[model samples]
Target chain A: MKVQISGLCKKYDGKPVLNIDNLTFEQGRIHVIIGPNGSGKSTLVNIISGLEKADHGTVAYGSNQKRFEEVRGSITLVMQHPYLFNTTVFSNIAYGLRCRGADKKQTELLVKEAAEKVNLSAFLTRKAATLSGGEMQRVALARALVLKPELLLLDEATANLDPESIGIIERVIRDFQTATGATVVFITHNIFQARRIAERVYLMMGGRIIEEGSKEKTFGNPESRITREFLRGELIF
Target chain B: MDNITNGFFGALELILSGNREVYGIIGLSLVVSFVSVIISMFFSVPLGIVIGMNRFPFRKAVIMIINTLMGLPPVIAGLVVYLLLSRSGPLGYLRMLHTPQAMVIAQVLLVSPIIIGVTLAGVKDRGNLIQKTAFTLGANRCQALWTIIKECRTSIGASLVAGYGRAISEVGAVMLVGGNIKGHTRVMTTAIVLETNMGNFDQAIAIGIVLLVLFFILNILLQKYQGA
Candidate 1:
C-alpha cells in the first residue's frame, strides 16, 4: 500500500516530538527510515499502523486514500522488543491467522511456511518463553509474515539481534516484499543496514524528515548537511 | 487433654459415618459458597479486567474503592445486605430475607471485592501489552480481551480460589441472614459456632475438621487447574 502523511504533528506532555509536513512511502518497496534514538521513528510507524493516534495529522492508505479503520487489518507492525505470547511458538505464529478466522488446515499451512521462512520450523512446538531473544524475534516476525499484511512496519525489529539473526531477518524481509509485492517500512538506527536493504532512504532528525531519496542519491550524492553529518557518524544525539 | 482426644476421634467418626445432619450442613455450605463465588466471578473478573486494562476518569478512585471493599468486614457487608432485603427495606418485596437466597446475596457482596482486587492485581502488569499485541495482530476488541483473560488465567484462578475461601469460611453474614435454621439454611461454619456455644465441643471440632478438609481438597483442585 502507498502510505501518505500530511500535516503530521505530535507532542508528549506539550513538547513537540513529531512535526512532518508531508512524506510518502511508495508502494511495493523497502523504505528504510533511519534516525538516532528518540527521533520519533517508532511514533511515526505507530501512527501509520493505527496503533497510535497522531495529535494533529492525517495518514491515508492505498490509492483510494482510505482511513485507518478501513485498512487496519492489512497493516502490521513488529516492535523493537516484540512481545511473544506465553504459549507454544506454533500458537504465536498462528495467532494472526486465527484472528482472521483462517481454518485450521490453512492456518497450519501458512504458519509452517512462515516459520520455515524465518528458520523457526524446529521451534514451533517449544514454549515461546523458553526461546532466546533472537529466536523470539524470529517468531514475532514469522507471526507477522503469515498474515500477509499489505503494509508491514518494522520498528527496529532486528535491534539487539545476533549477526546470524540479523542476516536472516534482512533476507527474509527482502524476500517477503519481493514475493508478496508489499510495502515494507523498516525503521533502524544502523545506517549500514539502511544502505544494504533500503531501496529508498528517509533520514529523520528530531521527529522531522531531514532528507529522503533513493539510497545511492541520499548516501553517495549531495543532500542536507545534517544528513551528511549523520552518515559520517558526527551528528551526535 | 481427654476432651481434645475425644474431639479428634469424634470428628473423624462424624465425617466417616456420614451423619445426615452434618452432611446437610456441609452440603449447604458448598452450595451457598459455590453460588456466591460463581455469581461474583461473572461480575468481578470482567470489571477487574476493564479497570486494569484502561485509563479513564476516576480510575484511581475506583481502584481505591475496590481495595477498601476488599478489606470490608463481613459483618458490615451482612448489615448492608440485611438492610436491603429486610421487610422495611428496598428489596423486601422479593421476600428473600432470612433464607438461603439472602445468605447467598450477602456472601456475594462479601466475596466480590476480594475477587476483583486479586484479578486487578493479576492483570495490571501485562494486560495492556497483551491487549495491544492482540490488536496489532488483527484481533477485535472482544478477541483482544479474550487473549488478556487467557494470558492471566492463573491469576484469575487464584482470585476465584480466594473468593471461594472467603465465602465458605464466612460466618457473620450467613449467620445474620441465614438464621442458621436446622436442616434448612444452617452451614458448616454457623453449625460450628452454634455447637461451640452450646458446649458441644466435640461436634464443633468435627465440623471444623470437615471445613478444613473440604477447603484443602478444593484448593488442590484449583492449584492443579492453574498449573495446567
Candidate 2:
C-alpha cells in the first residue's frame, strides 16, 4: 500500500510535461495534488496509474519495490471525464467484477453494495447514457470502489457534480478511506476540495512537486510564492 | 400515363389478392437478398472490425481495395460471376448457372464490400473511446472487441440495411446469373425486367411497387433499430 516514485519524467511531442524528483504516498492516507491547468498534475497521476508511460523514472510499490506490471491490479484510476458504457447503471458498476471473473451472484452483490455505498442504489436500472454528469461520476466511483484496490486515483472526479452530489461523494470517499484504510491520490484544481479531503498536500507547479506537507501547513503557511499565489487564487497561467 | 396508373393499382390489387406470380417473385427476392445479407454480415462485419481496430502492413492498401470494390458496377460483378459459373468455366462443374443460388452468390459478392467499407468507417470512428475505456477497465483484447461491437451495434444495423437494399434492388447480377427462370429464380428485379420486355407493364409495375415497399420497410426497421 506504499508507493515511492523517483526521477519520473514524461514528454509528449518533445515537450516536457511532468518532471518529478521523488515522492511517496503512505498507506491509509488521503493525498491531494493541487495545481493550475496544464501544470502536469494529471500527467503524474497517469504515469503512476500505468495509464501512460514515463519517459524516465521508477515507481516502486511496497517493501518489495514491485514495478507497475506487478502492482497494476492493486491500483485503479478514475479519469477526469468518466467514461460510462452504453448500458444500465447496474452493469457499469459490475464491470470490474465481471472482468475479474466474478460469478453472477457475486457480481450482483458487489454492484448493489457499491451502489449503496455511493447512494446510487435507486438508479441501478437506469440507462447510463441518460444520467447527469454527477450521477456518472458516482457510477465511476462505484465501479472503482467495488474492485477494492489498494490505491485509488481520482482525477477531478467531482468537478462536474452539483454541490449536493459533491457533498455526498466526498462523504462516501471519506468513509471508504476510513473503513478500508486504502491509499487515495486525488487531483483537483478546486482549492477547497483539496483542503476538505487531503491529510497531506502536494502543491505542483510546472510539473514538479513544489511544496509538500500537512494540509494545514501547506494551505495555512505556504513556503513557495507559487503555493502562496495558488492558495490565494491569484496564480494564473 | 394511363398505363402507369393502371399498372400501379393493378399491382396493389394483385398484392391484396395474393396473386401466386406476385407472391413467388416477392418470396424469391426476399430469399435471395436475405441470404446474401446473411453471408455478407458473416464475412464483412468481422473484416470491417478487424481492419478498423488493428493496424498492419498494407492495411491502407486493403482498405483502398475494399473502397474501390464498394463502387464496383453491378453489371461487371454479374459478368464476372457469369464467367466463373458458365459451362466449361472453372466452377462450371457445380452447374450453378441460371439458379437462385448463383444469383445469391453474385449479389453477395456485389454487396459485401459495401457492407465492409461502410461498417469499417463506422467502427473506426467510434473505436478509440471504446478501446480506451475498455482497456482502463482491464478488458483484455477479446473483451475490448466485444465492447466495441456492442457500442457500434447501430452502425452495424445501418450497414446491414444498406447491404440488403443494394442486394434486393440489383437487377444486373441477379438477372445475369439467375436467367429469370419462372418459378425457380424469377426474383422481383428480374421479373420486372422480363415482364416489361414482354409488354406486360402491369406485372412489371407490380413487382417494382413491391421492391419499393420492401426498401421502405427495411429503412424503417433500420431507423428504429438505430434509435433504440
lDDT tens readout by residue for model 1, B40-81? 999899999989878899999999999999988888888998
Scored by lDDT, the top model is: 1
- The positional error of residue A22 in candidate 2, measured at the CA in angstroms, is 4.2
Clashing pairs in 1: none
- TM-score, prediction 2: 0.85
Q: Model 2, residue A51: displacement in angstroms?
A: 3.6
* Top DockQ prediction, candidate number: 1
| i-RMSD of model 2 (Å, 1 decimal) | 1.6
Leading candidate by TM-score: 1
Instruction: For candidate 1, give the lDDT of residue A163.
Output: 91
lDDT of 2 by residue, B3-120 (tens): 8988888878888899998898899899989999998898899889989877789999999999999888888999999999999889999999999889989999988998898789
